[model samples]
Target: MPRSPSLRLSVLPLLVSCLVASGALAREAGDTGLRLLHPFATPTPPGAPNGAAYIDITAGEEDVSLVGASSSVSEVVEIHDMSMEDGVMRMRRLERLDVAAGETLMMRPGGGEHLMLIGLEQSLQVGDRFPITLEFAERDSVTLEVQVREAGEEGQAAGQHGH
Candidate 1:
């Protein structure tokens, strides 16, 4: 039995639509699993050369590594970790920060880890917001709208948690 040309033409559109919709759904589900919680930066003094951003990154079902970050507000952004060596505090650039599956990595000031924004074009003030793109090794990159907070203010206390 030969199929009619009109019937085949109609079926093609239906098949294409189904495939497109399915792909969209899959991406949405996968991307939603990884989330940035309470992203914020502290206010910087006038003419300060550097500042830091803190956030809680919650990983999904699979492990992911934070490879890099970028922002227009600064000339360079780097992941850093603070530690004590011979009773002296030391900060160093980290190549990658790994977030294990079903785990959260907390980046906080005065803590162990944070994102260093170096060579600021302008001083960051309270109530200001900026866009930052976070790159990951095993998942899609996410752009976060980071809000500036008072110096030493914690994001958890300000209730800025988000998915």
Candidate 2:
């Protein structure tokens, strides 16, 4: 059946509006509304080794970034992200990782961005925690105790935040 042009035009506007609204909703979900994700169990090494830290940091009411990281464990600490180039996976250093306001940024091995620990005095095992200092442009310096887990993730992404 042939449809009228005016009828299609009217529906077009509604469809466009619906798509725009949907995008906004997705962004809102990604953003921190009134709460934030707090970092937990941030593990680092003493000397130097190829390792990483997996944690979930709560974002404040304002947007921020996980700019840089440091620890007594490693001589060098850097915020890094894992990406693939030409199907080859590579770990790249980042100036900062964005944290949406009132949202949580998951720094895991197999997802998103994470901290890469280079050169370790000793390798980390499960049931271990160490001190990790975080530096955010907006937030002041915060020292946190990070727990180490087995190869795979072991802790639930937990934190507390309110407006």
Candidate 3:
């Protein structure tokens, strides 16, 4: 028998918190078959208009589409993709991102995909923590705590591309 979704969702935060308190580097959460892992954001300079966050998402028994997100740290949150087109870097907003069953969607700094925090309410300093809610299509949304780390710390590459 598998754990119930509600039960898992309820306990995930405590589990993740304990792990982090024990010196674990990453944070994670999930409900049903979808798991969110290693959510972190970069520190922002004073008066910066925007910031960015990255996370890795793993799909379990079913496919999941990440449709949107919200956070108190910013006025708006957007899903964005950065890629090279004709030798020029381009960033585009995405309506939704799909992760197939058993696949993982990895978001990182300086390239690929990320969450854009537009109209930042305040500068994100290192060690700052906040909540960001991720909405999935036809599934329950989950709010995960995001930790602020300096770029390049915790194995994440450092770059402010597309910011």
Candidate 4:
């Protein structure tokens, strides 16, 4: 049986909508709801055993915790925070860094939060890039490409907000 032109046209939009909605759902399933911005690492000298990577991460509607991280360039990847205790500076590993819903967390050098890459496999040079995976407590891990920049260069400095 031949269908009327009006019926076919109406069905087309429904079909298209279904396809679009399904695609959006598929993407939502894989999405961690975390956004990474301006991820970079400081260049290290030849034979330097350690380095750090910094970035800004924004949590989505649901609260998430950054529990750990991993990288191919370093044997040990740890979340660290630095603070002044009394008159001395101290840095320590963080078991987990929380990101509340709708909050943006900035990981900057000389600050309270950063990723510590220890036992580096090779020295990082300016313009070099590597991959690092960020683990979250309630979502799938996210892998990002990190660029190596000069030690004094701060990426996305003005955008720091909400910690």
What is residue 95's positional error in candidate 2, in angstroms? 0.7
38-106, model 1: which lDDT tens digit per residue?
A: 677999999999999887887887787999999989999999999999999899999999988889887
**Candidates ranked by lDDT:** 3, 4, 1, 2
> Per-residue lDDT of 1-163 in model 4, one digit per residue for the tens?
7878787655654653453343221112133355666678998899989999987778778888889999999999999998999988788999999989889897777768999999999999988888788898887666667778775655443345322
lDDT of each: 0.75, 0.58, 0.82, 0.76
- Highest-scoring model, lDDT: 3
**TM-scores, all models, native as reference:** 0.76, 0.64, 0.78, 0.75
Candidate 3 pairs with clashing backbones? none
Q: List the residue pairs that clash in candidate 1.
A: none
lDDT for 112 in candidate 3 is: 90
Off by over 4 Å in 4: 1-33, 155-163
Q: How many backbone clashes does candidate 1 have?
A: 0
Write the residue-wise lDDT of candidate 2 on 54-120 in tens digits: 5566665778777788887667778887888788888888998887776767665564577776776
Q: Choose 2 or 4, whichever is better by TM-score.
A: 4
Best by TM-score: 3
Better of 2 and 3 by TM-score: 3
Tell me the RMSD of model 1 versus the true structure: 9.1
Taking every candidate in turn, the Cα RMSD to the unseen true structure, in Å, is 9.1, 15.7, 5.6, 9.9
Clashes of each: 0, 21, 0, 0
